[model samples]
Target chain A: MTALTDDTLPVTSRGMRDEMIVFVVMALLLASVPFTGVYPFFVMQALCFALLACAFNLLIGYGGLLSFGHAMFLGTAGYCSAHALKVWALPPELGILVGIAAAFVLSIITGYISIRRQGIYFSMITLALSQLLYFIYLQAPFTHGEDGIQGIPQGRMFGVLDLTKPTVLYYVVLVGFLAGFLLIFRIINSPFGEVLKSIRENEQRAISLGYRTDQYKFLAFVLSGTLAGFAGSLKVFVAQNASLTDVHWSMSGEVVLMTLVGGLGTIFGPVVGAFVIIAMQQYLASFGQWVTVIQGSIFVICVLTFRRGVIGEIAHYFRRSL
Target chain B: MQALYAQLLVGLINGSFYALLSLGLAVIFGMLNIINFAHGALYMMGAFVAYFLLNLGGINYWWALLLAPIIVGIFGMILERTMLQWLTGLDHLYGLLLTFGIALIVQGVFQNYFGSSGLPYAIPDQLKGGMNLGFMFLPIYRGWVVVFSLVVCLATWFLIEKTRLGAYLRAATENPTLVRAFGINVPRMITLTYGLGVGLAALAGVLSAPINQVRPLMGADLIIVVFAVVVIGGMGSIMGSIITGFALGVIEGLTKYFYPEASNTVVFVLMVLVLLVKPTGLTGRAA
Candidate 1:
């Protein structure tokens, strides 16, 4: 006996047509952020995390794999891009691309080894692997141990664009966010993304359908890792620093909170979740350890009662994706 | 040779804690099928509880060894009944998330009250000195910890492997629904199993308090290492966890003597090797 699907909840779109319309509207809203007069730096930082969360959502929301070590990509790319800018004198765009490339390569190897197992085992592998990386970074000379790579020059966007100015940097981050968002949108709409969702919903059936599920998972992992890296690279510029904290397990936990708060398996959820969490942290910085406690409480409450996160609940209730 | 023997002693001490922690963890996992992320937090709490008893009520370390574990066990059982019990029928990952939240909350609360700086818990007067072996002078407290934890680990292994209650626990593990149909209060057993498992951690905490400074993060890092130890040992059996814990700890300790730089990573490196050889872990059944 099939129980009632939670799909009839409000904000849930009945079909793909409405999804496209809402997607356009959301993009337009983001496009208009320049006129809002809020601090460009904060928005830039949020967008970076949002993009990283969206990329993370691609795997968990669509592929049903919860990676606990995703911050590896974020931190790796941030460190890589920062190093490139500082040591190689590469401009922002090229440096960020290089960072993404490095993460993409690392994800391929990590994804390959990790995909050999599933579920809890998969999570453990990633966590342990990243922890291993964390130690390596802590010791590696370029990282400067605990102090991290700091005060890297905010190189100009190309030769003509001035990144030192806050407004210009804001647009750079905004564009990066939009590009990453659209890329996620494109992938989800594409055939590859559909197969991924099908696999997530029922892996056995997908395998029976002759789809190379492992390859798809590997590709998805790389894509997710690459985008996460790009976001991290962008964040280095926004925050003007890269540190061990970015790659720590806690950072990975924060991303999970973001994706969950926004809405897993829903577009636009990560953005909403990122802003809410980031704003919460910004205000609650003085509380120190309480932030962790509150975040944990939210995790428990959401998993137990909410089940559906903010955007997920809203989408489920209204019968449309916002 | 002398340095190697001393490093081995250090490794064994580390291993004793690992063995005890992993043994408890394996027991809980065997019954609950939920990885208790709060395990480290409970271990920390066990020590803190003892510390509190000593500082606040003037209860000494000896009394703490007796009382702290029971208190932690009862607390753990309550958690199992209240929160963890609900998540049972769902995905194993959900249980992990719930417990992780619990771990965060417990650690956060303790950190709030005590801050990050660790408090020292002194060794009892009974276990104050060291034995000067021909090769190595072993601290009495360290030797006591290794032997005491070994006794605890072996006793637990015997309970599960030889006794009747453990039989019920194991039978429930194989098929809880069937065990429940047989009129066994499987739910209560599961809850108690978690408590017992956590009690084991608390005992380790009490044992370890004197050796390692009691801190909010004491068990955080240690748990991760224990996880690697568990993976390496393969949680297929309680004996497996114990053997792997001690063996790996000694290996790590020896690594510290021979090639100190690789000491931090020797365990992880071994884990990678184990995965390559048998992805299920050295003693773990293939999932």
Candidate 2:
């Protein structure tokens, strides 16, 4: 489960506006780092997870559903894309498509089952369903068990662009992240998004209006899963590996933490949250297992004292959605 | 023939733990409307406590079985009082998150001390050896676990369904504000109910310790499977949890018999199928 939606503080307050302004300056500052010869791979990783957080916010922030098995989308797409490249020798474009398509299909089946139960039960169902997929992938001959679908040839995009070069890969992932982020912004602003918010606010009223609320929720879950798969597909290319770690429940918790730390319902909070969490992981990678303790501490602290999250609290204080 | 009986035995054994754990979850859900994510962690702790009691305190299996649940129940009461109580009247998700955090902390501390490798919990002298029924041999500890858990399960059912205190619990679960108006101190009852639920899980842990090795990660894996059990059972009824727990365990055990490949996932696959045809669950009341 994630943070409650009703507790979001208003964005117009002074602390929030100052925070938004700071975030914009920070984003711009981070954007300029590649030119200064800072490692772009780390930056790309942060940006990809940032986009994922934004996609996840669509469901938790607007739809009021906490899915505990979101990693299925990411890892499923990763595995799909990897397998496509390995088995079919398909171009990178088709590989990404394969990943997205697989993730979409998986989400539809999982969503139908999970949406039957709302709140905590929904989370558990999604989690168990994802675990089922995990076991399938674990034993499926194609997954190669512990080795995973590794050494995947990041084939030429449209049979031309060389992906071995880090710069090209960075640009591809960056564009993908931006597309996801902007699409989420648009989704939040659309009339459909308003209906989702209404459903979140109170399902009874929406159902009373004959809105077919479950359809919206299912679609939202699929959309979130698909985009998360896109991010996962990109991740495998960046890391050049897609293992069981990607499918584990911990990855799901990581995304939840990123969204929670950034802001549950807010737009930009997830990005900030992802960056912060990933950065912590990078810096603390040397510390070994203590990272889990640190992550748990963060979960506790965010739930206890900083429920609005970094971006959401800032947005609320600033009186804007951000 | 031997394989079938063995699988049936395994299924029945798993069913006992499933019934116990899910029963606890349902009881807690009935009162506070929060899924105790830390339920697994506490279950693991029960096994660990029994282990420690044997090693450090020189307590035998019987004494630890009685004491571990009490200790774990007190821990649950403390959790209910400290963190969970604060989240009341808010959205239910927060309660889940709070418990998840608790689970993380408890599991982490144990892992730090115990490592991931499992520690063996030896069977007591009283429950040693195996009994052969010509077709199959049953280990005494396994038999005791199944029989004792069923007794606990039935006793719990009786307490909730037939007793006076359980009537208050059911009443409070129905409408806490109204129950409070009736001067039942429903808040305190809710805390105690959470404790009781947690206590039940710990009891399952004690039962499981003899058969399964006590590892910090033991409950983490088992709890997820139990969650699938809870889903298939449907949280709308208490008996549903116990019956589905056993039935699914048997199904799972049989899956292991016929096709070992699907053993790990048979329950989850069943969960999906149940959700498809009867979303409210086989025994659950319609939402």
Candidate 3:
């Protein structure tokens, strides 16, 4: 699962230009969403998930660490951000920071324990740890148990940009998603990203080259988790609630599906995948549980036939790393 | 004292399920190199199969016990033959993803029909009463579940550790090419091994139905806990999973008595502690 062909493609200057072009095109398309009047709420929710999937892609797609419990970060961040905004009366910016900081600490602690192992064990360990948190949040008073921290206040950012306004919130979420996407994009192309990819491809070889592979993997895990937390914080503003649904293992699976559907290693794939899945859910909302069945079928199909994903296939056909 | 004994019994019963499920996981992992994420869903399917048999077919508990595993085992073999077989030689993660998809589909379809509620499965006539021991009153069906699960687990162990076929299975696990060179059909063995593991899970589901009630998502959360047990026990040996599963269940039961709040989290806590102390697990060799 970690060994996708796109990760191995040589990063020439032309490939970099192609990715930049796709990123700009994607940004413009998202920025013009409000004007197109295609339901700002749906796009905002999808943007949040797109960021989450991108954060997830940073780990599994590049770092070769598949943390099955990525939802823990998202849940923790949302809960914290919700509590901060609602209970503490913190501004939107501070609430988001609180969420990010909590996720940062959580990822560090979890990464320390989980990164000790690699491959499947890493996935299981992270999963177990996340379940541990899920139970904690279930019992914790701040989360209000099953009711969750609902009706969170979407306070103005710096007392200027009002988050309660839908259009303003959408742009804020869009900008947050873009910043996170670019950060991940930059990280993947950096020298450190190269080392992380090497560790993914062959950890022993990377270690032989004096890379201190564990630290590199640990850093990648932390970054991916924190960014996932950022997405969660952004999500609380959009959803106006923090609930168990975000933290559930099923949500983790959904992020994985999105990445797989969009193409794991492709820069633009998660963005497209996020839209595709969230749109599927929005359109198929009446089908209820069948959505899960459909998503599962997608997972099976992706693994069996569409392993390269939509973006992956397109990039492969064009011989470009979009 | 009575309450403690009761919780201990409850823990023992849970330990039985955990041991059965994790033991099957270890066996399948050894053969297939895939961590059978669908094991939980298959276990749930077993309970549902028993429900369907009793409610629809009017089959008795005893027959359901005999048939649920076989039926679910065949379903598992088909799954292995049709879907899981293609995952050979890919990254282990792909197998996990594929099986996870299977689980979601199975559980989702069941939930669609069952509505996420628990459906009752009555204890069989012979095991409807309770016996008062010196320490505690033991429900006969609960006792049956524990004892029967122990017997099944042990029989599985004996079959795998002591028999000729077991040697071939173990040898194939070590090197499928060499085992195939010795005239054993390796792929067939892989399918049968999957069936056996899945059958064990289904059997656990059957045992759990009367006590826990049949539910669509029954195995969903339980699988996560079993994964913790697997990590703590290290999935290295058969006995390791059994002992760890039971021990953790007992510990969880004790926690429910002493600190009810911690009962849900104790296994995961122990997994972390184990990883910190011995990353390879108690009886596991290095991964």
**Top candidate by lDDT:** 3
Across residues B7-120, which tens digit of lDDT does each residue of candidate 2 receive? 888999999988999999999989888888888999999999999999999999999989999999999999889777877777777767777777778888888888899899
TM-score of chain A of each: 0.94, 0.93, 0.97
Say which prediction, candidate 1 or candidate 3, comes out ahead on lDDT.
3
Model 2 CA deviation exceeding 4 Å by range? A1-3, A9-30
DockQ of candidate 1 (2 decimals)? 0.49
Residues B1-287 of candidate 1 have per-residue lDDT tens digits of 87888889889989998998888888888888787778999999999999999889999998999899999999999999888888766656666777878888999999999998889999999999888888788889988888988988999999998999989988998999999999999988988899899999999898888878888988887877787787777777889899999999899999999999888878877877777778788777877
Better of 1 and 2 by DockQ: 2
* lDDT per model vs. reference: 0.85, 0.85, 0.92
TM-score, each model? Answer: 0.96, 0.96, 0.98
The sequence of per-residue lDDT tens digits that candidate 3 reaches over residues A154-228 is: 989989999889999999999999999999999999999989889888888888998899899999999999999
Docking class of 1: acceptable
Report clash pairs, candidate 3: none
Q: What is the Cα-based lDDT of residue A151 in candidate 2?
A: 92
Give DockQ for candidates 1 onward, in order: 0.49, 0.53, 0.71
